[model samples]
Target: MTTQNRNVEIEERHVEKKTDSSMVASTFIKYTAYIIIFFGALYFLVRYVFPMF
Candidate 1:
């Protein structure tokens, strides 16, 4: 048995970037809903949950 080193060349194909409109809109909507829910919870906490201190 003999040990040998070999070199290999790789070829890459160019790919086109595509954007999905519905995906972008849904992501934006999801983030907006998260912000609204966070603020709403914070408001509720301040209004009713923290007064017992």
Candidate 2:
């Protein structure tokens, strides 16, 4: 019967797990390092480069 076939198909179904790559600790650490480097460069430019003019 169609109902029995459907039951068999449902029973054989697989479930997959999905994970977030961007929200991981390594990603957070990388972005934080980038932000720190950017701010450090900006500070250097303002403190040293701009004063020469």
Candidate 3:
């Protein structure tokens, strides 16, 4: 019984770690996408949109 309980605890910890890692990866991807879009928009404005005035 004690051994089974230990195994369960270990499995739970592993799952928790995996979930944390996935969350971090997703957050990083989201931020990177946002940054790229922001820079792209800024560049476009400076190169083409701004000159129209």
Candidate 4:
């Protein structure tokens, strides 16, 4: 009985780990767009604004 209970607990932990991985993937996808836009704007500033001096 203890072994069975341990197996169930392990399965629950695996499920929680899967959900945590998905959350990380979702956050990465969400931030990737912002990161791209931020770098793009920075590039534009460097290309256009710095040449004025």
Candidate 5:
């Protein structure tokens, strides 16, 4: 019974770790996409819109 309980606790810890890692990965992807979009927009503005002035 104790061994089974220990196994269950270990499994829970592993699942928590996996969920944390996935959350971090998702956050990284979201922020990276935002950064890329911002830089792309800035580049477009500088290359075309600014030059028109």
Candidate 6:
């Protein structure tokens, strides 16, 4: 019974790790997307709007 309990605890820890990793990955992706969008907007203004003036 103790061995079974130990196995269950180990499995729970592994699942927790996976959840943490996925959360980290999602946060990274969100930040990356925001940075890309910001840079793209900046590029557009420098390339198009600046020349129009």
Candidate with top lDDT is 1
By the TM-score metric, which is better: model 2 or model 4? 2
lDDT of each residue in 1-53, candidate 3, tens digit only: 35443433444444443358888999999999999999999999999999999
lDDT values for all models: 0.97, 0.87, 0.85, 0.83, 0.85, 0.85
Question: In model 5, where is the ten-residue run with the lowest total lDDT?
Answer: 9-18
Error of 4 at 18 (Å): 5.8
Model 2 — which ten-residue stretch has the worst lDDT? 1-10
Instruction: State each candidate's clash count.
Output: 0, 0, 0, 0, 0, 0
Cα lDDT tens digits for candidate 2, 14-53: 8898778766878999999999999999999999999999
Q: Which runs of model 4 end up more than 4 angstroms from their true locations?
A: 1-23
lDDT per residue (tens digit) for residues 1-53 in model 5: 35443433343443443358888999999999999999999999999999999
**Candidate 1 lDDT (Cα, 0 to 1):** 0.97
Per-residue lDDT of candidate 6, residues 1-53 (tens digit): 35443433343443443358888999999999999999999999999999999
RMSD each, Å:
6.4, 5.1, 9.7, 9.0, 10.0, 10.0
Q: Which ten residues in a row have the lowest lDDT in candidate 1?
A: 3-12
What's model 3's TM-score? Answer: 0.61
Off by over 4 Å in 6: 1-19
lDDT of 4 by residue, 1-34 (tens): 3544343344444444335888888999999999
Q: TM-score, each model?
A: 0.67, 0.62, 0.61, 0.52, 0.64, 0.64
Whole-model lDDT, candidate 3? Answer: 0.85
Best candidate, TM-score: 1
Better of 3 and 4 by lDDT: 3
